[model samples]
Target: MSKQPIYLAFSTQKGGAGKTALTVLVASYLHYVKGYDVAVIDCDYPQHSIAEMRDRDLKLALEDDHYKRMAYEQFTRLDKKAYPVIESSTEKAIDDADRITEQADFDIVFFDLPGTVNNPSVIKALTNMDYIFAPISADRLVLESTLRYMVVINDVIKKTGVTTIKGTYMVWNMVDGREKSELYGVYEQVIAELGFEVVKTFIPNSLRFRRELTETHKGVFRSTLFPPERSQLKGSNIDALADEILELIKLNGNG
Candidate 1:
């Protein structure tokens, strides 16, 4: 039987919207926590943040003992399983994806697409995906770009009969629940009116995410320097979001 891998395409026509960050987080969680053999396709050519982050983390793991220890401890608490293997590929064609899928032996393949709808290669890649996750922040410009991308995806689905596009979702990244942000209500209303699914979990704006990049060579962070309280809480939140995403996948019969 042919191996059917779960294809997740992360795209938004808006950069600096946490697309790469969330892609790495989800790929890490699935590999470390769920024990899935995952591979990341870096479709975003110029700024391959996902690939860069993975490379930095790997180098730190090899050179810094303290960082390695910290990373091991964190992974232990999160999954106690094998660490996810992340790699970079700049394949811009459907045939290229098929070749990668055949050779990588991955159960889940994620495409880190560029933040634009005009790329023909990206559109070709999206055609082969089982899930298209568009992360949108509570910003006017970002929202406008994301909505335009969604419209393009809708048209593609209509033309190609690929139901895998599922729907566009607004992930409340860098969100502060305490304050009443005007864009939050407006975006939520717009999403609902357009019949899109809004993920229940929100990724709050915190320094912890930025700190995840600064661990020692051993993947260990200095507990005294950066207390574990916030990291632990953020880890829990990420775990919840992963679960919610999995639920969405299952609901669409893709998981």
Candidate 2:
């Protein structure tokens, strides 16, 4: 039997909350490292960040000997093509994803949706997701905005029982190592009061998280075509994050 493709997004209503970053990393991790069939629907229209990155990655891999050789070795070993990134709008995202699956079966199709829920089409797409992982930070404004967003998603969308959404989780991103433990404890209590679960793996704040395919950088930390090199990923907690997401999906009986 063909398994149903899981639809997921790393989302929050707050801008600069690391939604797009997490989407690319986790999608790459699942596709390259874990050997899952993955595809990305870049629905953050006008930007199409992931799609653009894919283009940049391809160009760099062609021009730079370091990246070119790495790509060659990876493709030779894995014998799998880089997962496709489809440029789409929020209104047509679900339809585009459905069409992609019909062409090539994917284990998961990640959507990089816009950071606002004001539009009905965006809400409609959210309702179609099997899971949504909202990345939160230690900042006061980020926390407040994220909590508010989760309330709407939980009370308005998931509770309707008319949607495919199984869970909406909180993932701690860009965490400062020097922050007091008490602060996070209080935040956790608030999150629990709001009735949302957080992913166990907290991503530490690091410059490596911001690294992209660049002309000067010899090592790749983030790419749409390949997983972050193991050395670059050392302290990011992304591998653990991906594993936890899969476990949660399985617990929900979708894996």
Candidate 3:
């Protein structure tokens, strides 16, 4: 771990942009695959998708053999322990994230924020983030919303005056191979000008990503159902994404 109590969030003003899915992906990777302490705050207000997903996962993990074996293998790889993931609202997520880190000795905390910034509570929650990642598709509407969201996060950085976000990254999701259209390059150029990074490890356009994940609560990518190593996702895949994230933490210097 670069430093303790690191806080990062997955956010975008657009719904269904893979915030919760990627949140689980990264958190599970850190905890099970890399053997670091991690937790997640599902602060998506009305939806609380993370919490609901956890419940569904528990159901299937108990009933399904593959999920049960996956959980068993993860614990066996580690020391037979579980990481903590809590659901909180904006008003309490910041404090709770810190409290859990301190008390539980968590290396990183992930926040799965709501899809809209219209809520003031949600806006306030960004002040606690040390880094923020936004997953975006190649669609025009999503790009527009993502651009507006980046501006809002930049504004929050200035307004807070406390280095709320050390870096902002846009994750290219559902990408149709590296052979993107001209539109994709243009968006990357614009985002680079805004001082944000486009993560190199892109998730390929695959129904595997769209697979209903309730059956594998221990993880989606790390689970045996969709092994990252053999899957057609990308190099390092989620594992590489996790490594890049750790490198990012080194760049942030205790953020």
Candidate 4:
């Protein structure tokens, strides 16, 4: 029997912080590379980006020789099928995740939630998650928005002792070498003072993050069906992020 699925979300009230991309990339890494049974509940309705990506991935794998061969070789090597990405509304996301997990033994179920907390269902869905990874960028507006959002999540909901959330983490995204390291340190210190822990792995800015598996592309970096190419993962810090998340999960007795 598999353990109860650990619910997680890469969330923040701020848009353009790479929540969907991180959700897909990290879920793929954990499922395909780290030998975990994973699924995703795409509750970002109207957009349903991850579910749409899955659709595009299927098409690409069918019509594109490069993707088809890559998919075939990867599936054969891993002896595992692609993880499920369920499109659902925020109100039904938890129930939908339960139904899917009941059908298959999944170690983790990642949720791609809406970018705003104004909706009651969004708050409900977030409260049910076992872990929340909020992405923050170096920009002033982004940081301020993330901080205010985290205050609601950390102080208002989680601290009230009414949620399943075990740990809420802040992840630094879009980190660039051109930026001063001190800027990050100062932000980290502020976040720490607010009693939030930031993940040690900082995801560097890279064009590969925006790339997808296409007919002409030689390597696949992000897909619902396959793990990213090792070369594409180079300098992305995804592996380290996965490791740190797993470590935190283990520490919380959920891994």
- Clash count, one per candidate: 11, 0, 1, 0
Can you give the TM-score per candidate against the true fold? 0.78, 0.95, 0.84, 0.95
The most accurate candidate by lDDT is 4
lDDT of 3 by residue, 1-255 (tens): 234677899789888787787787777766765666777888887888777767766677678887778667867767646656687898888888877766756678889887777777777788778888888899989988998888877785545686566778889887776556787888899878877788876766665554445533432553322234344335436667777888877732232
Query: Would you give me the overall lDDT of model 2?
Result: 0.89
Candidate 4 at 70: error in angstroms?
A: 1.7
Please identify model 1 stretches exceeding 4 Å from their true place: 1-3, 69-96, 162-164, 178-183, 215-230, 233-236, 251-255
Tens-place lDDT per residue, model 4, 1-255, is 356888999999898999999999999998898888899999898999999999999998899888788889989999989999999999999999999988888888999999888889998998999999999999999999999999999887888888999989999998988343988999888999988899888898888898888767856788899888899988888888988998887732343
Per-residue C-alpha lDDT of model 2 across residues 184-236, encoded as one tens digit per residue: 88899989987789988898888887889888864677899789988988888
Give the lDDT ranking, best first. 4, 2, 3, 1
What do the candidate models score in CA lDDT, each in turn?
0.64, 0.89, 0.72, 0.89
- In terms of TM-score, which candidate is stronger, 2 or 3? 2
Model 2 residue pairs with clashes: none
Cα error, residue 162 of model 4, in Å, equals 1.5
Per-residue C-alpha lDDT of model 1 across residues 1-255, encoded as one tens digit per residue: 156677787677787777777776776766655556566777677766666666676676657787667667866675543333334333553555566677656667778887666766666677777787777777778777887787788776535785566545667777766454776877789888876667887777765555554543222221211122333545436667777877776632233
Number of clashes found in candidate 2: 0
RMSD of 3: 3.7
Q: RMSD per prediction, one decimal?
A: 4.8, 2.0, 3.7, 1.9
